[model samples]
Target: MSAPAKASADPAAPGERQGTRRRRHKGIAGNALWFWIFVGPFVVGLLIFSYLPIIWSLVLSFFEAYNTATPSKFVGLRNYVDMLTDHNFLSSLGTFTIFAVFIVPLTFVLALALALLVNQVKIARAFFRSVFFLPTACSYVVASLIWKLSIFNGVRFGLANTVLGWFGIENIAWLSTVDPPWYWIPLVTVRLWLQLGFYMILFIAGLQRISPTLYEAAYVDGAKPGWQVFRYITLPQLRATSVAVLILNLIAAYQAFDEFYNLVGNVNYARPPLVYLYSISLGSIQDLGHGSAGALILAVIIMIVTLLQNRIFGFGKAGD
Candidate 1:
């Protein structure tokens, strides 16, 4: 009773608190409105374009759908069975597997080497980066055309053949010859050129994120200046980036279509799954069910491979 009035009992204090709460609520509502304004379109677009297509494709894979205007009949797993037994589909899978085996390691090593080289440069770093990365900006279709018609053309005067001529070697048909599958040379080279710069940039970003103090500590412990430092420190730090690059490279290799389609034209020797599926679904007699089934199978294979890679790499683990 004799004590001074408490601060909480002040007449103005409750009104001030209420005013502050009102301001906070208004601020939160305004922020929420802005967030939805910015993000709503993207969410709507993803649902309509990406997720919906995936769902529809899954549904279509179960039916006996063709290119005709007639309604599709449900044939359950027949399309999937046909895809499994199809010779062309099997050949395409084999072709893609071989391509992946070659391209994955080649790109990984070359990209890492280029990244290391570029990272050590003391001048014109941006210029060097741009030069390496410029090819990636070129369309696959355009690049394939250049490689096919200009560089590896079967004629005696083609760029590759001309270079061989200078060395007293006979002109080679780089694309059409299948006795030894010489087409692989141009395909591999073009893919390497197109993708090397991208992976190099990724590695460079990974390198930059590595703490310099680790290198300093290694030096203090009498570590050597070159391979030892990289072997013991740099490589370990790049594990995550390496995993990502490998996975991406694998998927890209599996999905390879533009280069093969443009370079080989109508040849059936080097077709990948997508090319085969395209012929099935849209070429001649269209079979949308078989195409959808093959697509889902390819998607499953990619998913399984990626998961296995992640498990092997221990990706997402705290120390990894």
Candidate 2:
């Protein structure tokens, strides 16, 4: 009889247990309130600033938004379709593609080499690193202005022309010359000089992460002085960092504007898409719709390139 009564009482015990659970539920709700209070500012800011702006941009891309006195007009995909047929848009893409083809690989290789050399040095390492990175601290406009007026200036007053005179050669027009001679040489030179140090720092950090013991093991296996352990050990270990540096270089090369703007101004010979967009909207004519259309097209291209790179190189993968 006592065992049967105890068994029957067990079913009623849940009611008391339910009261305990209700207390715990109230406590959890209070804790959640406090957590939200602490984090609410950041959440609100992101929603208002970042997300809202993105929504606005997407909306504006569908309509003709002007910076001038004209009223906004709904043009759907007219801007996008016009972009496909625009010769200047095609030229800009072609120009940037060519620039990236040369610049990206060159930047990566040179930066890696610089990092290796700097890492191996025992003395004045800090000084050399600072010297290399100094160019990055300078504004692109300042560097471009100096290069335009002093270094690669086409005038007899320029340092380059002065040097050529020493070899009994006539002072040549450096900037005005069409392609292989004028535009690319100085552009590539300045671009490399400015960007190399930043990428070198990234590579140096990657190199430091590699274990010295691995290098020692390779050396024990009779790895020669000039022959690198990079093929087997260093590269595999630093694959993530290499992919990161490549992606960053790709984005920078595509969005390049300040250097080209200051050096070449409105000159189409070396104009990148961003520069051309600026020329159309802000500089020459107040064609805001065209500029926005160009900008949106560029955004799409960047997105596509990023996706392709991620797929090909597994860029988003961590060390695992």
Tens digit of lDDT per residue, candidate 1, span 88-182? Answer: 89999999989998999999999999999999999999999989989999889999999998999999979999999999999899998999889
Report the lDDT tens digits of candidate 2 across residue range 210-312: 9999889989998865547767887787788888899999999999998778777777667889988888777758666677777878989899999999999
Model 2 scores a TM of 0.82
Local error of candidate 2 at residue 131 (angstroms): 1.1
Q: What are the root-mean-square deviations of the candidates from the true structure over C-alphas?
A: 5.2, 7.8
- The 0-to-1 C-alpha lDDT of every candidate, in the order given, reads 0.90, 0.82
Off by over 4 Å in 2: 1-54, 179-181, 318-320
Q: Which residue pairs in model 2 clash with each other?
A: none
